[model samples]
Target: MSERHPRILVIAEAAHPEWVSVPLVGWSLAQALRDVADVHLVTQIRNRDAILRAGLVEGRDFTAIDSEALARPMWKLAETLRMGQGKGWTIVQAVSALSYPYFERLVWQRFGPEIARGDYDIVHRITPLSPTAASFLAGKCARAGVPFVLGPLNGGVPWPQGFDDIRRAEREYLAPLRAAYKLLPGRGATLHNAAAILAGSRHTGSELPASARHKVFWLPENGIDPARFNRVAAPGDGPLRACFVGRLVPYKGPDMLLEAAAPLLRDGRMVLDIVGDGPMMPGLRAQADGPGSGVTFHGWQPHEAVQDILSRAHLFAFPSIREFGGGAVLEAMALGVVPLIVDYAGPGELVDDSVGIKVPLGTREAITTRFAAELARLAKDPGALAPMAQAARDRVTQHYHWTRKAEKIARVYDWVLKGRPEPKPDL
Candidate 1:
């Protein structure tokens, strides 16, 4: 291990500065790492313009691999298979499994010599965060004696029980076939050869084979860029101001959130701000339209508007049942708004009693009841939420900020370079 900063080749095929979801995550992480390591980012050609706009010299700071010949066609196929946009995410990933190899193959073709000669201390693949997306670089780097790090790999959270109707509505037809990813080519070799694996969630961490468990470390893939989400909610003298920001789809439980908060909205005990749009908009709008139902629908606001609404909010009432990363929850928490999320999957894992609230997972009716009860209780005593909101903000600053995540990843780089030390980083 070098005493100087580790030279890392960060591979994030989906990274893009202007996008959200996986692309933003990959872009944020890759940029953050530059402060701690000698990072050379390699990404797909589609992100080249965005990367250039962000001020990086092409072929010097990064290299854009043109894999569109295969990626474009495969992406079109995935779009068709998904049935509709933003639906059938599982189907998209399942189809992408076939085309991702081409990107890595081109990456190796260009960088193999430098990697083989030990020019880079480590090769870290940060995107295609799906645990199912096997890496060709893992075995290649392993054979070259250069340590390779995989993930904050997330996804593969099974649809929880009692959500079959919503699952079908969301067009997640391929979810039952998700386990077949383990049988994909290079899946075994990628896991077996990686020097360290960063599992983004506990569910994802548990999915790795027993042999790979020893090298795995828990690190949530979602992170907050403090500058983007720095607003702190100032609870004024009024009803509890709550907001729900996500697609108005069955799985996100927007309808359930509306049902739960309906009483409060009608009684003037709470004000609800719904900050997104989806297929269920017309139905949800109708559901909220009665006397004194203080529900405001700011349909599909930009990130800035979302943050504006969240900053003035006291509670973030997001009842998403099967969220994998829960990035919106983090965004809300970053704004010092206490989140009330279901006690399952990503939200359950990100929050605890000190920072936010979590209601037990159950059927749609049961969850709605629980959420309603919690919202009523909170509305009755809004002053008690202040402490939790501050704690949530502090938690994000310490752990969930992109800078902090980069620092933690730097520690990971050190650990892997130090020959697999005992007591892995408990980040």
Candidate 2:
């Protein structure tokens, strides 16, 4: 079995294709891994129906562990705190940290015998993407001599200075407290016991304990399904068509985008397509309607409609200040749309001069100034768009596609099994 496709038990606390963000990541990643490994996905009972709808036999392809009795109270509290937006997401994770172990314990209770019998080559915990959460099965895998893998775990990027106002608006007061997570029970042991660890960003990698740093490899959490983000034959030759796709919020910087792009919008030099709705929408609409404004507010477009908009556009100007998983950015890139994002956090790490444009992190006024200048430069010279757009497509095809990511992680599994310390997977 070791010589063939390595058998894997993939543990995902949140996984369902119908779900977005981390849950969608869990679904996409687990399915992609099956292309290279013999995988039996294990997820929370909440995802059971969706998984079945996607056509997998229960007990054979996947197993749903039921622990709602232990997790319901915390979940309910988090939902109440959520108040219908992203503010509650952090609270959900905080509550989930306490409940995750019970679910993992149930996984071990049911699958422990098979692991001990060497029925599977490895056990990997793929979600609860936060490093703050503790893993329950690392020690059990060690005792059974089955290698354990943790992460692409992400989070804990310090809020960039000068964004205090935005930080407050974002309800991220708990971000600084994340350093305290290192002291969480079993975190150190979880890091120490894992055969290989994949960090989703540079900060996440840097946050790992010194002892475990050597085995840690860098891999971002975002991966594009080519089927969903298909490439276009030829981009439109119309007005420098640009779009911003994300929630309308201060941290996402849609307001900043509007401020910068206003000059180009005047006199019909460019047309801005705003594809999402948020608290900032009313304010953004007012701003976009002002002098020299050629912006269209296509408030809250559906998933497929977003792709259609990108397919016809030349540039995707998303100037988000603190995006962790720039899935939208990657989706735009996969469709040959040139991305313009800030140079900090995930988008900063993902896009370079080679792929798309990067505006350095700074005060809002300064970023708006530089961001507008870059857009103006590109608008003035349309020739630069094609090459950068092509480069963006190539970068995602080479590095960020789902199946490519799956193959790279399969190599990590091989690397862990060989017990080497010098070379990490070049993800």
The superposed Cα distance between candidate 1 and the true structure at residue 348, in angstroms, equals 0.5
Candidate 2 lDDT score relative to the true structure: 0.85
Q: Could you give candidate 1's per-residue lDDT for residues 172-260 as a string of tens digits?
A: 98898889888988899999999989999999998899999888988999999987887888868799999999988888888899899
Each candidate: RMSD to true structure?
A: 1.5, 2.0
lDDT of 2 by residue, 208-317 (tens): 88899878988899899888777562555656788889899888898898889887888677888889887887788888885457887888877777888777778889
Using lDDT as the measure, the top candidate is 1
Error of 1 at 396 (Å): 0.6
Misplaced by over 4 Å in model 2 are: 82-84, 290-292, 420-425
Relative to the true structure, candidate 1 reaches a TM of 0.98
How many residue pairs clash in model 2? Answer: 0
User: What is the alpha-carbon lDDT of model 1 when measured against the actual structure?
Assistant: 0.91
Cα error, residue 78 of model 1, in Å, equals 0.9
